[model samples]
Structure formats: C-alpha cells, structure tokens
Target: MEIKVNDIAVDISGRKVFSNVSFEMKKGEMVAITGPSGCGKTTLLNCLGMIKTVDYGKIMINGKNVTKYKDKEKTKFWHDYATFIYQDYGIIEDASVAYNVTLDKYKMNSDKVQKILKKVGLEGRNNELAIVLSGGEKQRIGIARAIFKNATVIYADEPTASLDVKNRELVIELLRQCAKKGAIVVLATHDERLVNECDRIIDMNQF
Candidate 1:
C-alpha cells in the first residue's frame, strides 16, 4: 500500500492551518509528524486520516486521488483499511478488554481474544474492565485493537504523550512491530525518543 500527498493545504475559518505539504508513505514504514504545538501537526494527521478535508492539492492512496473522496468512500476506506490510536486510549472505558478489542466484530472466543491480547502484553486480562487498567495498559489495548483489525494504515496521535518511560518504550516497540508487519504507521508525537525510532520525519515547522 502507498499514500502520497502532493502540495496539500488546509484552512479553517479563513485561517490557513497548513499548505503545500507533500510526502509519501509506503507499507512497512513508520513516519513521524513533528513540530511545536499549534504548528498543524495534528491537522496534517487528520487530513491524511480523512478526518478533515484539504482545501488544496491532492491525497492519493495507491495512485488514486482520495482528497475528494465521497463520505461513503471515506467511510469504507476507514472501515476496511485504516485505524486510529488516540492518546485517550479510545476504548470503551467501562467495557472489558476483550470487548474493547473485538467489539463484537470478532467472536468472543477465548483463544482468539487471548492471542490478540498476548501480543500487547495483556495476555490474561481479557475479562478485566478497561477502566481498571493503568494508562500504559490502556494504550496497549488500543494497539491490540488495531492489530486485531489487521489494518493497513495506522494513525496514532500522541500515543505516548501520557506514558512513563517504560510504557513509552513498549508502545514504540509495538508500533515498530506493526510497521515491520507491512502496515503504514504514521504518528504525531513530541517525544524525541519516539521520533528517533521512526523511519522518516515530517516536520510541520518546515512547511
């Protein structure tokens, strides 16, 4: 899979968030979006993830322009090929870890859930409530969901912003593993450690 952005730009309420940004990402690659706060890092990620629209230029996936994809098309793209991991963990706080990962999409069989959980170091915590887990564990659950979905593109926004040193390293390792498995991982982060682990960096301040 491939994602290409050519001279893309975005504006909100007459204020330009970013413009003339271009980059390409391939499968099995991890790219970092870096810059100071308010420099449009998240906005750029949103554009790439199809959560926001660009006012100029084009975004192409596999050589087809997706910048102007219809809502239905965008929804299908998200459902079939992409997933997001947010700083907040993005799982149902009151739900069981198994439920958060499968969400009834996959059968609630123990072996299936356990295998996925084990990948993120939550091996036997499937029955535990997400609300009871630590922040690092919660983030692992988020990564577990992405792995379960077998998503091709992963967008992580400040995934390690709230973690301590050990958990931050763990999250970084998991994201790297995803890329190694042929997924495109794009993350927005201020963590220099995370930045150094990426294959490439898109510094928004340079745009």
Candidate 2:
C-alpha cells in the first residue's frame, strides 16, 4: 500500500504543530522521522496514524482519500490497516501477556497467542502481568500486539528509548521482520543506530 500526505498542516489548540508537510510512504519501506525533541515528529506520527486530523491538506492511504471516510469506516480502517506503538509502551498492567496478545479478540485464540509470544521470544512470559515485565519485555509485548492486529502500517514512537543494548537490538530486529513481511514501518526516533538501518529518513528538521 502507498500512503501519500500532501501539503498537510496541523494545529492543536491554535498552535502550529505541522505545516505544509508532505511525503509519500510506499509499502515495504522503512521511513525514520528524526529530529531533536519538540520538532513535531510525534505529531506527524499521530496525524499519520489518524489520531490527529490535519488542519489543512489531504491524507491519502493506499490511493484513497481517507478524509472521505465516515467515523465508523475510519475506525474500522484504522483497526485493520494501522497499528501504533507509543513512546511509553502502552500495555494493560492488569492483563496477562496472553490476554494482551489476543487484545480481547476471540478469534485470536490461545494457540495463536502462544505462537506469537514465542515468535517474540516471550513464550514463557504469557502468564506474567504486564507490570512485572522488564522495559524490553514490555516493548516486545507492544510489538506482539501490533503483529496480532495484522496491520499493514506500523507506527512506532521511540520504540527503543528505554532498553539495554540487547533488548534494543531485539526491538530493531522485530521491526525489520515486520518490514520484511511487507508492512510500512514508520518510526519516530532519535536513535542514530536505528536511523542508520532505515530504508529512508524523513528528517523533520528539514521542514
């Protein structure tokens, strides 16, 4: 799928977060949005994820103008096509890893959940509570969730910010695997190491 953002501008609370930003993200491509803090990288990711609407310009996903989609349609499309991993590692503290992996989807049975956990090297941690896991383990669970969603586009914000070297690599490798399976992996990150491995870099500073 191809994602095209044309002359996109966004303002929150009357403050300009992004202005006239435009880019095309093709499938199977890894794009890194990098800049210093407060450069609106996360805002751009939110816009791309449809968490925030642009004040001006158009957002086209896979050649369709998503601006035309109704709320229900947009929500369904978002659930099916895009998944985001937030900077804080969004996880349900009270849920077991298996539940987290299934995300309350009945079709995602225990067998599939266990398989995904193993795929993420967290097979034994399925029964563990989210809060008990290490930072890296939490991040892994986040990735597993995205995978479970079968998303075509994955947006990750500073995905490896709090991990040790080994876990950091694991996250990076998982992202690579996602891309290999034909998802558009867009990352908002300041890590030079992660940026270096990206297929393309959208340097927000240039805007």
Candidate 3:
C-alpha cells in the first residue's frame, strides 16, 4: 500500500493546478491534503487515485508506476486495490443500507452486510433508506462500503464537511483505523481537528 508521488504536475485549460509535487508514504500511514480553496488538494488525490492523470512525473503504488500500467491494468487496480469515499455521500439515496453496502447480493450476503454495518455503528439500520439517514450516518455508510471492499488505499474527500463534533470525530476515527489496519489513507480536508491527527499533512499550497 505504499504510495510515491514524484514531480507530479497537473494543468487545466492551460492553467497549472499544481506542479513539482513529490511525496511518499507507506502502508499504515495517514496523510492529509490541506490548503486554501482551488489549491488542487482534491485534484492531487484524484491523480494519485488514477481518476485523473498527471501532466508530468510518475505515481507509484507498491513500487509499480501506475502511469505506466495499461488502461485495463489501471482500471483493475482502481477497482480492486483502491476505494474512494466521496464527500457527497456516494450512496444510493433510494436504496437500503444493506444494498448500498453490498451493491448486489453476490458481493456480500445479508449476514456479512450486517456485520459490516455493525463495525460502522449502523448495526440495525441495514434496512433503512439512505435518504432517511443523517449526514454523519451517511458518511458512516461510505466508510462501511470502503471497509466492505477492503481496498489497500482509501481516498476520502472532505468526508466530514458538514458534520457535528461527534460525527466528525467518528469519521476521523474510522479513517484512522483504516491506516492502523495497514491501508494507506489519504484525505482532502480543511478541518484542522482532523488534520492534526494525521501522520503527515501535505499542504498543497506549499507548491
């Protein structure tokens, strides 16, 4: 689950979003990407996660240069080795929690879904519609989904943007445990409280 970003650069519409970025982290490490608005914090995460390709330099995951991998190989790596916890909840508003966790019955049985729900503190809310859950609960569902997938790298973009103190703590703790479990957890956020607890903070504005 090691990640290495060397001289990474990105541009949009002839405007440079970020350039000459370099950093490295190993498994069990949690890194927070933080900076002012439009500083490319989220963009860097996308690049590292292979959602967005870089204009220059290389992104290495577990010693393999992702930029060099074929399209199909990259797609397979993204699906099987990485997971993203989107800020907008990334859940089906009309679907049940169990359905969102497993997507289809083949991924995980009802029993396994319940166990995952319990791990995220959603134990008995399996049958509840995603729309009925609060923002914090929805975030928990995203974490639960990530846990279910068991990806080696987890990317969370402002996962606690609109949550109260308690919920924010819960979200941060869940992400922390992901790192402790030997997954590389990277999150983009403006929350100082969350940033302070990370193993390292990569301030995009530094570039």
Candidate 4:
C-alpha cells in the first residue's frame, strides 16, 4: 500500500514535535527517516503505524483516510497491514524463538516458523528461549516475526542502533530483503550505512 502523511502536526506532553510534516511512500520503496535524536523520526513512524495519534493530519493508505479510524478499527488496520520493529527487540524473553515468531498465529506450523528462522540465519534456534539468544539473534527473531506476517508495510524504529558492526549489517540486509519482496520498508535510523543503502530518504527535520 502507498502511504501519505499530509500536513501532520504532533505534540507530546505539551512539547511540539513534528509540525506540518508530509510525505509520500510508494509500495516496494525503502525509505529512511534520518535526523538527530529527539527530532521526531520515531514519532513520525509511530503515526505511520497508527501506534500514535497526530494532533492534526490525514494519513491516507491506498487512497483511504486511516487517520480517523475508530480505536477498534485502528487495531484491525494494524493487525493485517503494518508491523513495527522496535530497537529494543521486544521478544518475549520466556518464550521459545518459535513461539515468539508465531506470536498469535496459532495455525502456523513448526515447519513454517523454522523455515523463516533459517531465512533470517537463525536456523535450529527455534527451540531456544528468547532471553538465551544474543542481541543479534533476538533481532533476527523480530525479523522472522515480520516476515511470517507478510505485512504490507514494515515500520522500524532505530533497528540497528544497539548492535555492533556485523549485526548492524545483518539487520540492514534483512530489511532490504523485505523491500525486495514488495513490502514498503520505512526505517527511522541514524546509521549512515543503512541510509546509504536505502532506496529513498525522508529527512524528518523538514517537518
């Protein structure tokens, strides 16, 4: 789906963040949102994922206004269309990798989960618990979760921030794989290497 953020203005706790921000993202396009810390890059992403409400704006997805969705309707919209990868790798620590990847998809089989785990270079680790995995492995589990969902858009917030060089490259490549498969990939990041590799860049400071 194509995403358009029109004349958006946002404030958090009486502090102005983004103002009159607007952008258009095409399907299969990988766009990077870059700015200094606290510049509202993540906030813009949250708004895109419908995780945060903008004080004023219209979010159009495939020509439909999603900004006005009711709370329950917004939940449904997020379930099927978008996936957000947080920087901290929000995997369930006690759950096995397989369980974390499958999430709420009860019908998904072990084979499918294992296959995607392998795709993210986490083969044979599905039986391992999330807390036992290294920082990189946990990030891989997050990638596997998004892939299994086959989401239309992936909104990632500082996905490579906490990793070392090698793991950072791994995460960037995984996101590129998502874009190659025709998903709109939007990343809020400070990593120059990642920004250089993306298909487009959105400078949130323009807001």
The TM-score obtained by model 4 is 0.95
The TM-score ranking, best first, is 1, 3, 4, 2
- Full-model lDDT for every candidate: 0.91, 0.86, 0.89, 0.87
Better of 1 and 2 by lDDT: 1
lDDT of 2 at 20: 76
TM-score on alpha carbons, each prediction = 0.97, 0.94, 0.96, 0.95
Candidate 3 lDDT over 36-72, as tens digits, reads: 9999999998998888989999998888899777889
Which residue segments of model 4 deviate by more than 4 Å? 105-109
Residue 62's lDDT within candidate 3 is 81
For model 1, what is the error of residue 151's alpha carbon versus the real structure, in angstroms, after optimal superposition? Answer: 0.8
Q: Give the range where candidate 4 is weakest over 10 consecutive residues by summed lDDT.
A: 103-112
Off by over 4 Å in 1: none
Better of 1 and 4 by TM-score: 1
Predicted model with the maximum lDDT: 1
Q: Answer with 2 or 4, whichever has the higher lDDT.
A: 4
| Cα-lDDT of candidate 1 | 0.91
Candidate 2: the clashing residue pairs are none
